[model samples]
Every structure is written in C-alpha cells, then in structure tokens.
Target chain A: MYWITVLVVAIMILSALAVLLLPNLLAAVAASSVVSLALSVVFVIIRAPDVAMTEAAVGAGLSGVILVLALRRLGLWGLGDDNHPRPGDSLQGSGDDA
Target chain B: MRNFTSLLFAGGLGFFLLVLAADLPVGAAPMVAGEGILGQGPEAVGAANLVTAVVLAYRGIDTLGELSILFAAAAGVGLILSGMRRRADQRPDPEGGFILLAAADLLFPLLVIVGLYIVLHGHLTPGGGFQGGVILAAAFFLPLLGRPGDSLNHAVVNWVEGLAGGAFVLIGLWALAVKGDFLAPMLGKGALGSLFSAGTLPLLYIAVGLKVGAEIAGLMSTLQETEAAEP
Candidate 1:
C-alpha cells in the first residue's frame, strides 16, 4: 500500500513537470490528463472514491476532449507541422500553397 | 527574473500549505467526545453515504451555488459560440462506418442506464449526481463522435435544464413549506439501505443529474458546433 502510494505520487509529480515542460500543446494536455488520473488514484488510496471518480471523469476525460477540440480549432494537427502558422511567427511566404 | 519570481511565489505558497497540513491529523484520530458529522450524519439524514448526507442535506445551498456556476459557464460558452457559421468544407462524413454508428447506438442506452443508476443510488452508495451527470453527458457525446455534424436538440436541452433547475428550487420550497427549512428532507427516510431511502436526497440528486447532464451536453454541442464552424 505504501509503495503504491509512493508510485502514484511520483507519477503525479512527473506528469505535472511534463505538463510544464512539454512544448507541444497536445502533449502538455495529455500530461495534464495523466496528472489528473494519478491524482484520482491518490484520492482512491485515501478512501475518497467519489472525488476520484469525478477527477477521472472530468479532469482526464472531458477536459482532455475539450483541449483536443480547441487544438483542432486552432488548426494544430500535430507536432512540428507548419501547415497552420502560429501567431507572431515569421511568415514563410505563401506556405499554404506548398 | 520571471522564473525566479514564480519560484519564490510557489515556494511561499508551498510552505504555507505545509504548515497548514502539519496541523492536521496524519491518520484516523481516536474518536473524541463530540459526535462528528460522520458519526451522526447517517442517522440524522438517513443517508448511508455520509458524503451525500453532507453534500445534499447539510450543504445543499453550496451545491446549488455550484450548479449556478456550472450553468453560467455553459451559458458563456453558448454565447461565445453563437456567432460562428458552419463551414461547408468541414461537414462531418455523411456515411459514417456501420461499425462506428452501430457501436454508438449500442452504447448510448447502456451508458444512460448506468448514469441513472449512479444518480439514483447516490444516497446509498458512493456515486452522485455530478459524476452521473458527466456520464450522461458522455453518453450524449458518443453519437456526435460517430457523426460530428449532428447536434443534440437545443430546445430539448433547454427544456430539461430549465425544468430540472425549477424542480430543484421547488423541492427546496416544498421542504420550506413542510419542514420550515429549505431543502429539509420532506418524505420519511425509508429503510436505511433501501432504494427509496434518504427522503428528498435521491430526488434532489435526480434533479441535479438531469440539470448537469443537459448543461454539459449543451456545452459540448456548442463547442462542437464552433469546431465545425468557419474560422
């Protein structure tokens, strides 16, 4: 039980750091979901199953879907793709035709 | 410099939280003289789940406020997305695969049943309206995954939201009329572990579940519509 708790806490910390450091917005969102999932596990360990269910459902599931939808709306298909130019970046002269 | 400032702020907050945490009991403390909420809550509220007793019976006003907050957020999202026009080029696939559509159809009703079960059993078990409502929303959301352009009936959503909201208030008013306290359990709490136990709590949770489900489904529809709209 102690080891499980320690493992979850470690994962939570690692995911939190990943969310902060990951450059790709989608990857950051994924990391954030992992953080939420790990936190839910912690909640379960502490006997707060209700809170755990909510965190898992809302934090990992709905929020992740919303974030991905927002990313799609921003025309960000994937990592390092220049099809949709981000704001404030230098224009590469009609790359839309490329 | 910005990083240093942020680090300093975070460190200060962490220290403050640690100090607060240090004051709390590490594990289950020996029962004290005074009867705590956990000790007396079930008998008082007739809810097997102490958490439900506290949330719906003891702190109902807080739950109402939370509902209002969620309503406001959903309303804001709807307002923001109202002006967007659907793009002709971005229409969802008209002929979604048979398997995808079939799966969505198969899963929808099952999910709804599970969601209702959770909400209805809130007083007796660990599940509640909030979690069940999200599940309900997810159930509604599944079909949209198969057919992205298809939207839930806004009029139906609005009606459900309005009626559920009104029902919650009316239930509280009824409690006030009967018990002279808002949100007081009206009907007699049945057998401790029975389906119909917890008097008005299960009813309130049902109302909450419907309201939250409708609200969240509406929010998702609005967001999906915006996604389908022209940039």
Candidate 2:
C-alpha cells in the first residue's frame, strides 16, 4: 500500500512538472491529463473514491477536451484550419526561439 | 533584474509549498465531518455510500446551487458564442477520418451504459451524478467531433435540460411540502446497498445526470459550432 501510494505520488509530480515544461502545447495538455489521472490514483489510495472518479472524469477527460478546444479557438492546432500554427511558430514565447 | 526577482518569488513559493506538503498525512483520509458520517451515515440516511448521504441529504441544497451555477455558466457561454455561430455561406470543418467516426459510433452506446450505471448505482458506489454526467457528455460529444458539420437538435437539448432542472427543483419542493425540509431524502430508503435503496437520492441523481449531461453537451456543442469561420 505504501509502495503504491509512493508510486502514484511520484507519477503525479513528474507529470505535473511535465505539464509546465513540455514544448508542444498539445503535449503539455496531454501531460496535464496525466497529472490528473495520477492524482486520481492518489485519491483512490487515500480512500476518496468519489474524488477519484471526479478527477478522472472531469479533470482528465472533460478538461482536456475543453483545453484542446480552446487551443483551436486560440489558433494553436487543428487539421485543416486556416489558422494552424506555422512551423516557425514558437509555442511558448517569441517565434524566433524555435 | 525583473527575471531575478521573479525567480526569487517562484523559489519562495516552491519552498512554502514544500513546507505545506512535508507534514501531510501520507495515505489516510483526514477525519473531519467524515468520521461521524462514516459511523452513522448509513443508519441515518440509509445510503450504503456515505458520500451520497453527505451530498444528497446533509448538503443537498448546495448541490442544487451547484447545478444552477453550471446552468448559468452554460448560458453565459451560449450568450457569448451565439454571435459566432457558423453562417450558411461559411464552410464548416470537414468530418474526422474513418477511425474517429467508427470509434464514435462504437463507443457512444457503451459509454452511455457505463454513465447510467454509475449514476443509478451512486447510492451504493463511488461515482454519482457529476462523474457519470461528464461521461454522458463525452458520449454525446464524440459523434459531434467525428462529424463537425452535423449538429444535435438544440431545441430538443434545451427542452431536455429545462425539464431535468425542473424535475430536480420539483423533487426538492415535494420534499419541502411533505417533510417540511427542502431536499430532504423522502420516499422509502429501501434495503441498503440494493439498486432500489436510498429513496429520493437516486431520483435526485437521475435529475442531476440528465441536467448535467444536457448542459455539458450543449456547452461543448456551442464551442464546436462557434469555431472561427473559414477564410
């Protein structure tokens, strides 16, 4: 039980860091989802199944969808949109950095 | 200089968070109102899942407020996105590929079943209205993602949401007029841990499930429909 708790917490921290540090915006969003999934695991280990289900469903699932849709409106990524991010477009900061 | 200052600020914040985390309980849930609830919740509320007791009986009105908040947020988004609705002259984005379409078709029914199970079994299990409702919304939204040009009937969606919300309120009002307390668990609680157990709680959850499912689907559909027009 201790090992499981430690492992879930570790994954949560790592994915949380990755959410901030990832270069690609979509990758960052995916990493954020990972953070949520790991946190849900932590909730289970803590015997908070209600919170775990909510975190998994809303945080990992719905929030990711919302963020990805927001990315579309903000002109970050899409399949055939006119406002697709250009190759030289730096995701985080000045376009020159990439 | 500004970068240095911000770095110092960030470092201080991190240190503060570390301090906060250091003495936290490792795996056990904190005993607060929960200790008492865990002991007597089933006897008092007759819900096998104590969380349902706390949510539906002890603090049911708060849940009602939460539902209204979600409704307001969805309405706000609709108000903002209404003007951005895709015009007939403008082209909508093409549907997703075969795999996405197939996945949507295959998964929708399965997801709906799982969502309903979670919602209906909430009194005996971990998940309830909110969790299951999100899954239901995802089920409803998947096909929309697969076929971006296709649209759900908004009028039907509106009616479903309105009726669901009204049902929730009417249930609370019925409890009020009958039991003299708003949102009190009424009817028979039945045998504990059974599908029919927990009286009006399951009914409340069903109303919540439908309302949240409709609101979330409506919100996501609006977001889908209000995409930037084609160049």
**Most DockQ-accurate candidate:** 2
Error of 1 at B167 (Å): 0.5
Q: Which stretches of candidate 2 lie over 4 Å from their true place?
A: A80-98, B17-32, B229-231
TM-score of 1: 0.87
TM-score: which candidate is best?
2
DockQ of each: 0.24, 0.33
* Cα RMSD to the true fold for all candidates: 6.4, 6.1
| B113-217 per-residue lDDT for model 1 (tens digits) | 999999999888888999999999999988997787788999999999999999999999999998999998769988899999989999999999999999998
lDDT of 1 at B62: 93
i-RMS for every candidate: 7.2, 4.8
Cα lDDT tens digits for candidate 2, B134-200: 9999999999998888888899889989999999999999999999999988888789989998889
Q: What C-alpha lDDT, on a 0 to 100 scale, does residue A91 get in candidate 2? A: 61
